[model samples]
Target: MAKSVENQVEQTKVLPQYVAALVANLLVASVGCAMSWTSPTLLKMDSGETDIPASSDEKSWIGSLTPLGAVFSPFLAGYTADRWGRKTTLIATACPVIVGWVLIACAEPARSIPLIYVGRIIHGLCLGVAFTVIPMYCGEIAEDKVRGALGSFLQIFVSLGSLSQYAVGPYVSYLVLTIFSATVPFLFAVTMWFIPESPYQHVMAGEEQKALEALQWLRGTSVEAVKEELAIIKENVREKMENKSTPRDLISTKASVTALYLSMGLLGLQIFTGIDAILFYCQDIFAASGGDLDSSVSTIIVGMVMLLASACTPFIVESLGRRILLLISAAGMAVSLALIGTFFHLLNNNSDTSSIGWLPVVSLVIYMIVFSIGFGPVPWAVMGELFAPNVKSMASSIATSFCWFLAFLVTNFFPTISKELGSDYAFWIFGIFAVVAFVSVFFLLPETKGKSLQEIQAILGG
Candidate 1:
């Protein structure tokens, strides 16, 4: 018994697929850095620290540009992943991501607003591609038992990236931070080059031998040990690829349409939770609340809580299932947002709010904890799990692009809403939407724990 336990530990020490998942997500982390860069740096830009004259309106545009750019990359990413395979397409994204960061880095020296805007647009474009491909690649490579855990890694790395920026960006010079962020994707590309392609993609292209080899490596087993699994993968791919699916096919059948609606619905709920607005403007939110801790320090605390919660979600989802977690998350978020809105209302009224100055920080921390565990990650995982393989790439691209499009709207308008309509109303609107999200998840979402892809298809068919 001791010998068996020791061997299990030894096997885990060299998990090549886990290695592949982590390295690929390093690029996702870079996207997270791009997504939240404005959190710490936007204030400095408005102060003329970067020598780029960005007024409040320009700052809004700057914060919104990444999501805007992300909305466009899905079409190209879906095409590239289908054509060149997932590994190659992921590696190719690094160049534009690096270039985007470099443009922002150069903006400080040239004092050019256009350079920064161009750089943010480039970042958004790559953000869309990463969101489209990473979940599919991770889902394709993971074992059935470990799939939820592995799928959650995408969100974990994103939290890691956001935490890295939240912790470091406030303390470092803007140029230095952008330069450091640029290196993450380059490292992702170099490390990703050494990993094997997804066996599913290999099978789709009729490269059975290559698929066998790749599966063997990913499974940490001998060729014969993986052959049965390889055959299953081959059959599944063969079934999915019997004919290509068209755009109209996405809405043609009940099952396909159901999957699409559920996927898009979760994303919609997630967006209306005002997650992007909160993330992009986190520090500013704390600053406005007159918190006890320094705004930067409070922001770091929020980041830490978010990262820890995200890291815990893999295990939690495995044990509890996805739909329940979403239910819990939406309910918790509603209460937290209402608390924050109340605090802001008191502040806006010039009422004595010093006693509850802690409310915003506490409320945001709760909000982060809940959001990290469920809506932040589950929707992306479920999106990959829902579609038939032939339409998986295309459906994911549409859902991902739409997710970012909603993010663009929220982030771009959040500050304007806070300024023009009072921050209290902004928080209240998000709180109300959280209530709506709770209702939607309870009525519509399905449990996906421990199910095979074929089983999931059947469930959606019902």
Candidate 2:
């Protein structure tokens, strides 16, 4: 056993390989999130050159398709990862993203809108696959102590990608931006070819010896530690296999079902609060608020603020705990949205342009900061923590699907809602969602801070 353990340790010490995998994972996630930022700019550019309806309804429909793709892609990718393996699924997903970007780049200015939707749908599908698989892959490979920090990097990179779009969009045409963005996914796919499969997936496939070897290579840990982890993984797999239920079995138990519901609700709240709407359409929002602000500059600033807040998350997430952060952030978001809504309401009601002078900008900045600190990081991080290994993929898929679905609703309705309900009422609606999210976090969210994935699973199981 000692010799075997020593062999495992020696095999797993391939630090370079792991680092490469981490980089690839980050690239994949970055490309996924960057799409959100790029699409609006691209659409605006296309609108300028085309005679397409350019109506609110048309814009919303375009926005809605991507999330619609996101809602379903995860289920397909999750199962594919389980059946086909993470590395293969990631590579396959990359192809569509690359194709999407290339198609977007080649589309004629006159023919671009529909092609743009196609590209978004394809990209959203890639995002769904990448989002589900990347975290699970990272979780499986990460050292227990550093898992939270490493896993949290997904959001950080996502923020960076978002920020990159804002920074890059004004300087480049849509075609150039699309071409540049394609490199991320293309490189991610190429790099992933050199990485090892997730050891957990190896173990799930009943390839214990391979699992041990993979874990040793990926983790660079002692044989004893690898064996201990392997045992835990095997037991989880055994339980899953013995149950003989489909993924739906995950929520068959009341507790598990409640957890799933709450997780989905949390994800839904993230979208329903109109964070994406505000982020994607910031220029419009600012213009509506009567600001003479340059849309691109304001967007870049917002993106920078988001990136800064995300950067701070890893430092505090493990120490401060997930629940508290969620509540605080939700409360902060509520107030900010209320302020934004009130400003817009005042403007709409009395045409009082003074309220938008500085307050709207300040409120938006504050709201972005608050959102970045809490909801931005906690949702993905907690989603990583909430589901048990057996059902994690399925639960994540369902939750993510719900999230995208609500995102579709919010993005699709934002223009109409703001137009009819007025921007103030629209923001007020988001404020109400934040308030509800605050309550949910206080009551339902578990504190998974400083806990390993296995430890979190145990807590959730009870």
Candidate 3:
């Protein structure tokens, strides 16, 4: 009996799921590169080092357009994912992003800022699809035991993509970087062509045979290895689809409405953590830091810190439990943001911050570390976990789209606020948001660490 049990455990293959998750996230990483592209390239534009001309206002619009484009597309994305399949949605979305990058690559030769705007908007539109479907696919395909770890790959890959841009953008020409960015979605498309659709998605489409095969493929094991799991998936899909999930259904029930609120609030606070402003304007923020480190080097260092933090999260998130990690992460970010605000405040007043030139980097490093572990990835994971499976798809689209809309507001106005009001005021405002997030985590957030999706929904259902 003991030998049989050990053999059963050894035969359970998880590597294939991990590989699929990683491949699916390649497009997400490209989104990151597009996000941070403006960070380095904006610097060149600001200083007239590039042939393309953008006034500060136009630059802000360029920086903010992706999120704005994202704001309007998630509902459509959800519709497509539900009707077609997660795999198809991911594959189809790649086309627009590739076109977007190509437009940006060609913009330099034309010296047209309008071309860049159109490219960014197109990229953003597709990104809404990526954000909507990726989490659904990741959460459904994973076993509950490893869901958090796998789900975190969403943010981890985003950071990895952004890090690649930060590390490479400063050294390369605009055309070279844009060309490289366009290639990422193509690679994602190629790799995704070979992976199976989520078993849950297949079940939703009433294809039990395909669902079984997909689960078997994703688990990298025989039918026997995944039989029980496939049964559970089928049962859940049947229950959830008694009434088809639609946007109107999201707010029809009290429990689902609460879940939607939780989703929006959780993800909304993540954006208010000032991550968009920090990432989009990383080079400028560092330049404003008055630090001894070169601005380009400083941006790279921050990107590295963010990437490492995001990578380490999946390893520890399960152990720490969701609420505790969030509490710690929120408090840490609040303090870090306050310290950064103080540094800026002092520097603005001519208080000679030469003695503490390192403060900004240290604070932001700490911010990235704590933010990555909890507020950064937990919201998306928990968002998927807490909703009733019936409303999950629509709920995800609303929450994700709302998050990007808030991101647009922040990214669009950050430059004006920093230059006109003061950078210190901006950081202080972000710090206050962090404080609210900490309180919310302590009082309202549930610890979702070891729970299955059904279990999580039960908690929210009450």
lDDT tens per residue, model 2, 1-462:
777766755555446444845665655555544455544463454447433435566677666677668778888887798898877788888888888877766664555567767877887777778777888777777666566666776777777777777777666766666677778777777777867787778888878888887776667665455786688788867887775546667767755775687678888888877887876566677666766566667777777887788778888776787888888889999999999888887778776576357777778788888787788878877775676656666677778888888887887788888888899999999999999999888877778877777676666667
lDDT score of residue 276 within candidate 3? 92
**How far off is residue 362 in model 2, in Å?**
2.6
Q: For model 3, what is the alpha-carbon lDDT of residue 61?
A: 93
The alpha-carbon RMSD values of the candidates against the true structure, listed in the order shown, are 3.4, 3.7, 2.6
Across 1-462, the per-residue lDDT of candidate 3 in tens digits comes to: 566445545676778888888999998998888888898899888776689989989999999999999999899987788899999999998988999998898888899999999999998898788887887788788876677677888888889888888898888888888888888999999999999999988888888889889887876777766667777887877777685766777877766877888889988999998999999999889988879888888888899999999999888776788788888888999999999999999999999999999999889899999999889888877776688766766777778889999999999999999989899999999999999999988888777787877677677777
Model 2: lDDT equals: 0.74
Listed per model in order, the count of residue pairs whose N, CA or C atoms clash below 3 Å is: 1, 2, 0
Instruction: Quote the lDDT for 376 in model 3.
Output: 89
The 0-to-1 C-alpha lDDT of every candidate, in the order given, reads: 0.86, 0.74, 0.86
* Residue pairs clashing, model 2: 12-216, 12-217
